[model samples]
Target: MSSNQAFESAKQEYEQWGINIDEVFKTLKNIPISIHCWQGDDVGGFEVNRGELSGGIDVTGDYPGKARTPEELRADIEKALSLIPGKHRINLHAIYAETDGQVVERDKLEPKHFEKWVTWAKEHRLGLDFNPTLFSHEKAADGLTLAHPDPEIRQYWIDHCKASRKIGEYFGRELGTPCLTNIWIPDGYKDTPSDRLTPRRRLMEALDEIFAEEIDKNYLVDAVESKLFGIGSEAYVVGSHEFYLSYALKNDVNCLLDTGHYHPTEMVSNKISAMLLFFDQLALHVSRPVRWDSDHVVTFDDELKEIAMEIVRNDALDKVMIGLDFFDASINRVAAWTIGTRNMIKALLFALLLPHCQLKELQENGDFTRRLALLEEFKTYPFGVIWNQYCQEMNVPAKESWLQDVQKYEEQVLSKRS
Candidate 1:
């Protein structure tokens, strides 16, 4: 067929799939919604509509952010948790850009920061997903270096993974953090579709080494992450559920779902959510995504929220942890957390509101749009409207730097009027 004919055919197929969003709204009237915590970015171009409601928040800390001062930060976090309805934790996809040391050397700061952070998680009952960027220099590489080629690196991972297991075992004991031992390499191509199979194979080898040893001794830290690109075109990481699972080994492996990593064409359906059940461990990622960009915000709309929560609610999945992958400028902290958490609750509330029979059939049959209008209707409903309300209600301070944005906008408006 001609290109125009192909386009028409595809449109026709999509038209059938498209449901009446209005009708979905009709179904979503006044459903209650809440999220444990979220990283919203309303200050940035990404508007997180949700922070109006019930839930705690997990946004970034400042200048060296809270991670730099784990103790004071942890105490602050624990206080916030106590104040809010629920407080969920988040692991930054990348640690600070300045981390060139192996560990954030306990003695590096005027007062050691690492020990305090360890103390905080231990005291507060917060679970963690440790993600160290491979970009950090040798001392800070967390023992495994991504600088090597696949063949050489595979062995390095094998060796390094042993140390990771030991460290994880210690952390688990010290902090009593349940999940431990996870790793993801940012070693994918920039320009050409470089060593596609090599990195994946090395990743597999590293995991196998960790699993064979770690699983029996203590709970193996679940390896969970998806594919994404930073600079160039080749996004070779595990970008989708189908592809993520395709390479997944049969033993001790778990599924990790990242929201922003997917190609625009990917869809998260009930059936897709069902696949997560196969893993011994599963975790859902929260990140804001637009057409081509992953902004990492909190408030996502109907379709985006639905597919995400369906995976979360699947009873079959074990150790179902939900965490945020927020990537906004450092200044918009409260808004980011508020909006992100609010959207998260909306997702959970969406699941709570659904009729068991209908939801089940929808999951079994993959009838996605059936929930679309209802989901949208949530924005108008008390729950959705309340997310923003809750954010406003919270005494949480806004980012100091972002306050300047208000003055600038006001000045521009006054000038225009004059």
Candidate 2:
């Protein structure tokens, strides 16, 4: 049978279980996954054209055709978006701003620095998200920013974050979508800190100062990201999950969970339901981690599925903000973007197609045997058939045919870059 016929049969089968496949497709179509700009360029923003990786973030492999400028990055992003289904947003760091060959310090950034980005986003009808570049600078060489003991240094980062919020507000105003501005500082010690409390306190005070100016929530959504440890921050990370979670809850802001930022055994999926209970809104940096915080490209793995299930199960899709946070420089950058995003779309669809109500009924009534059996049996269902339908309806290539386009792009566009 043809793929469409197979999907039709799968639809009939799922309907017998009371699953509305059409509603799942409609729901998944409306959700936008924000793709990280760093993936296209290996996190090498074009500020000053340094091209050197820092901020405790490292990208392995010297893959050719890394985007070296804003224009190239956008071109690459456009190509990747072509292969992935669904409407999506673009996440940008302050460092990606087009300064026209001028050195614009992070703290001194303004909406004007990103005016070109706003224009580009408007052209593509893509919502923009913002992040303050908090590391890989002279000031952050010591693995501290907002939590630095020097008030002058801390104030600089505070000013930079405040400026980022304004820029985020500007993007939202121009594009008519709320821009999420996330703050993730790489402040920590390689060894045990003599005083952890002082740095945490300083960070708290700095955050308060940065958020002092009020902006309309409709325009800007502020978030703080936490990490268990970074390369140099193996011994202590000031912005632990507890610290940021408490800060966000108390300050009426959003807490961001980066899957790769936690311990190996601890999954961000488990935290979603618990976080939703306390906060009305939450943010996620979806990425795959090998053993530590290694930002590998996302795949349709169990962890990814569980994260999607938690969001769909709690009916918190609208309340949560989903964004990609992976960069793999070893392979074709555009292919990495397409694969990660398409897999994320598949995971969400898988979650949406599950018979959650029926499973919940079994679990609530202590029918553990059947609940487990159904969960395992549902895994073998014809999910790919529906996924192919989704890709076809969204006008994107499916069944690995998208990789052909990626190869063509590499030959035509990326090969000519260097």
Candidate 3:
């Protein structure tokens, strides 16, 4: 049968359970996943002539045709978005500013530095998100920023973060969407630290100063991200999950949870409900981490499914901002974006297809055996048929058909790049 015919069959089957497939498709198409810009360039932004990636972050492989300029990066993003179904947003770091052959210090960056990006996003009808590039700078080379003991160094980063907020506000105002400005500083010690409290205190004080200027909530929403540990800072990271969670609650800002930032055993899915209870909204950086914070390309794995299920089951789609954060230089950068994003969209569709209410009622009523049976049964449902239908409705290629387009682009466009 044809794709639509198959989907209709699946729709009829799901309707037997009182599930509205049409409504689920509508909801999934409306959800916007913010695609990170760094993935296009392998986390290498066009800030300086030539600079190596630092600050506890690194991208493996030397994939040819990696975007080397802001224009090239935007082109890759445009191509990726065309293949992915649904309205989407772009996540940009401050480092991607289109400076006209001048070394503008991070502390001195302004909204004008990103005028091109704002214009492009507007033209594409896409929303924008911003992040302060706290690492890969001389000041941050010491493995500390925003919490550095030196008054001068700490002040520099504070100013940069403040500027990022202003830039974020500008994007939101221009695009008619609230921009999320996330702060993730790589401040930690390689080995055991003599004093941990001092750094944490300094960080708290610096955050207070950065957020001293209050902007209207309509344009910008602030967030802070935490990491358990980084490559060099294996001992301790200043912005641990507990610190950000408490800070987010007390400061009335969102706490961004990167799927790869937590321990191996701990699942971000379990933490979503807890965060939702205390905070009005939550932010997510969805990526796959094999071990530690090794940001592998995202796949439709168990955690990804659980995370999506939590959001759907809680009815918190509006309360959460989903974004992709991964750099896989080993593969085609544009394809990487499409693959990861499509996987995320697929996972959400899978979650929406579940009999959440039925399963919950069983668990709540203590019908353990029935709950397990229902849970297992959901695995065999015709979710793929519905997902194919989603792609068809979105007018994007269904299944792995999008990969051929990426390959064509690679041959026609990417391979031509030096």
Candidate 4:
């Protein structure tokens, strides 16, 4: 059925259930959402809380599973947003050159490219999940093997960020699309090959310099990514919820929580509580199987779903932004994204109604069983059929057009049985 039809169907469910259909619809009708992402092919348009955002810039917008010429990326964004209109935020992961501070100047993409991207995105109604300085990281367990992590990498990142910020500064002046930047140390290492303390200091010092550099802009910076590991036995700084809050408060950076990136114990709702109590800075990330090495899929389960609903209820929704963070090149990328998003929405709607009672308890007692249940709750997910019923019952548009689409996606994710 079409969106209008689905909306009508949802209205029926609202009435039948003896619940305020309009009230429920109004609550989630067009929620405040953002996505922490992996590589994506659809690019160039804007979708924010307000309306559709048009795409800008051409050539060189590639995330691992996605590679497009800047112009192609520009056009793709326009195409992608047509399917789901309105305000949508997209996270640009570590797409910068790190360690090589000055080498980034050689790229063909000009500041005009960055400026155009930001301007058109803002005018079109999309916010940027921009990491002023981000780079891909691979590990050897013994050391960190980042894309670029030496003097060359440092110079490249420095130039890229400066150039990128020049674009940020330009568009931020007129459109002011509210840019959220999360900078991670894609290459910080332990002190002299064995000293654990060195990595933290070096990484912190590096980011502090970057923040100090970009401090002029009205940007909120998150220091970590979901489970993004570091070189030689150390993970990223914002490992513990408290760690991020402490770092953000001590150094003055915003905590961008990637729920899927946390260790098993840190549930979503509680993570936000820390953000609220400590820094008051909030950011959004969505993924299923909360304990995966690589982001398996952009789906969610019940417990995870409930927490997402709480995220919306927290009224801190505005302080937060949401986005999709998964990719697959072997298959149709757009289809993959649609299903992933559909699963998230399905899980989210269910979570809205239920209570994460144990979540709060676990936060207080550190009980093992609650932790197990929380993990178990989201295991059999991407409940595509259940999600479809939800959208139908709620009078909401179905993000995923078909059940086959849902099944195909469910089969792809290996359950990390919480």
Candidate 5:
């Protein structure tokens, strides 16, 4: 049967469950996932004085044809965006700044360094988000940045973050969308520390200094991300979830949750509801963690679906700022962005098509047996049919047709890169 006929049959089945497929389409279209720019280049941003990837995070594999320049990275992102349905935003790190071969220190970075990016974003009519790159620098060689013991070192990072917020403000003012400027530091001890309180206190003070200047909330929204542990930070991380949660609450800033930043057993999906209760807004770095905090590309697994369900069912779609976060140098970088982002959108679409109200009622009524049964049965629903319809409606290649485009692009563009 043709795709349209299949979609009609699937629509009828979901409609029986009181699912408004048309309304689902409308809601899904407005949801914009922020695609990270690092995926195209394995987090290797274009800095004249680029350093090795450190801060307890690592990107393995020696994939060739990785984006080597800002222009190349932008082109790769455009290619991925063309394949994924729906309008989306691009998330950038401060290291992606273009300085014309000049040595612009992180603390001294200005909005002019990102003018090319703003121009490109304007051309595509896409929104931009920013992050302060607190890793891969000499000052952070000891695995501490904001919480560093040295007064000068802490001050340097503080300045960098402050500069990053201004750059984020610039993007928002130029693009007409508020920019989410997130600060994620790799501040932790490799082994046990004598005094954890000192570092936490230092971090708090540094953050206060960074956010001392009051920028318009309409231009930039600030967020702080926490981690359970990382490669060198297995023993202690300064920005623990509890630390940032309390800090975010007290300071009136958004707290960012990275899926891979939690313990293997801890589910970020479960924390969404609890967080929404206290904070007016939340940010997310949706990444797949393999056993540990290995930044693997996201898959449409149980947790991803649950996360999407929480956002949709609680009506926190606008409250939660969604952004992709993973860098795999193992495969085709462009395809990596396309696959991870498409799965994120797919999970949202799946959540949108579900009868969330009915499920909640079943639970509220204490009908546990029916709730479990219906949840399992809906897993077999024609989710793919609806996804294909979305891709078609969005004017992108449906099904596996997008892979062919990536392969062709690799042959024509990427393969030629040194």
Candidate 6:
């Protein structure tokens, strides 16, 4: 059957469950997923004096055609954005700053360093987000940044974060969209540490210093991310979930939840509702974890669906700031971005199409049997047909047809990168 005919049939099926598919489309188009820029270059930013990847983060595989420059990275991102449906934002790190071959320290970074990025974002009508790079620097060589015991080192990172927030505010002011500036540091000991409280205390003080200057919330939003454990920090991490949860709540800042930053059994989906109860808003770093906090590309798994459902059902779509955060250098870099981001949008679409109110009613009325049956039965619903329709309406290729574009781009553009 033709795609339109298939969609018509699927639309009728969903309509029977009282789902307004038209409304779902309208809502879905407004939800923008912040696509991370690092995926195009495997977290290797364009720093003149670039150092090796450090601070428990690693991007493996020697994938050819990885973006080596800021221009190339932006082009690759453009290609991926063309394939993905809907308008989205680009998330950038401090290391991606362009200093014209001059070695600019992180603390000294200014808005002019990202003029090209702001121009590109304006040209494409895209929003921009920022992150303070707290890893892969000589200062963070020991896997400690803000939490470093040395007063001078902590002050340096604190200054870097303060500078990053200004750049974020610049993007927001120029683009007319509030920028989300997130801070994630890899400061933890490989083994157990006797003085855990001291490092956390130092981190708290550093953060206070970084956020001491009051920037208008209309321009820039601040966030802090927490990690359970990482490559080097197996025993203890200074920015534990509990630490940031309390900090974010007390300080009126957003706490970012990375899907891969928790234990294997602890799901981020389960934490969404609880977080919304206290905070006015929260943020997410959607990623997949394989065994450990391995930054694998996001997949449309149960957890992803549940996460989307939590956002949609709780009516917290505006309250939750969603962004992609994964770097996989094993496959085509552009394809990695396309696949992960498409899956994230797909999960949201799936959540939007569900009869959330009816399901809640069933559960509240103690109709567990019917609820379970209906949930399983809906799994076989014509979700793909609706997704294909979304892609078609968004003027992007539907289904696996987008892969052909990626392949063609690979041959024409990416393969010639080196």
Model 6, range 376-396, lDDT digits (tens) per residue?
Answer: 999999999999999999999
CA RMSD per model (angstroms): 13.3, 0.9, 0.9, 9.9, 0.7, 0.7
RMSD of 3: 0.9
| Model 5 misplaced stretches (Cα beyond 4 Å) | none
Model 2 Cα lDDT, one tens digit per residue, 30-127 = 99999999998888787874545677898888788999889899999999999999899999998898888888888899999999888999899999
Please, what are the lDDT tens digits per residue for candidate 5 over residues 234-347?
A: 999999999999999999999999999998989999999999999899999999998998989999899999999999999999999999999999999999999999999999
CA lDDT of every candidate: 0.43, 0.92, 0.92, 0.47, 0.95, 0.95
Indicate the residue-level lDDT of 309 in model 2: 98
Please give the distance, in angstroms, between residue 200's alpha carbon in candidate 4 and its true position after superposition. 1.2
lDDT of 5 at 315: 99
Which TM-score value belongs to model 6?
A: 0.99
After superposition, the stretches of candidate 6 with alpha carbons farther than 4 Å from their true spots are none
Displacement of residue 417 (Cα, Å) in model 6 is 2.2
lDDT of candidate 3 at residue 24, scale 0 to 100: 89
Over 4 Å off, model 3 = none
Show how many residue pairs clash in every candidate, following the order shown: 28, 0, 0, 46, 0, 0
Q: State the number of backbone clashes in model 2.
A: 0
Better of 3 and 4 by TM-score: 3
Measured by TM-score, how close is model 1 to the native structure?
0.61
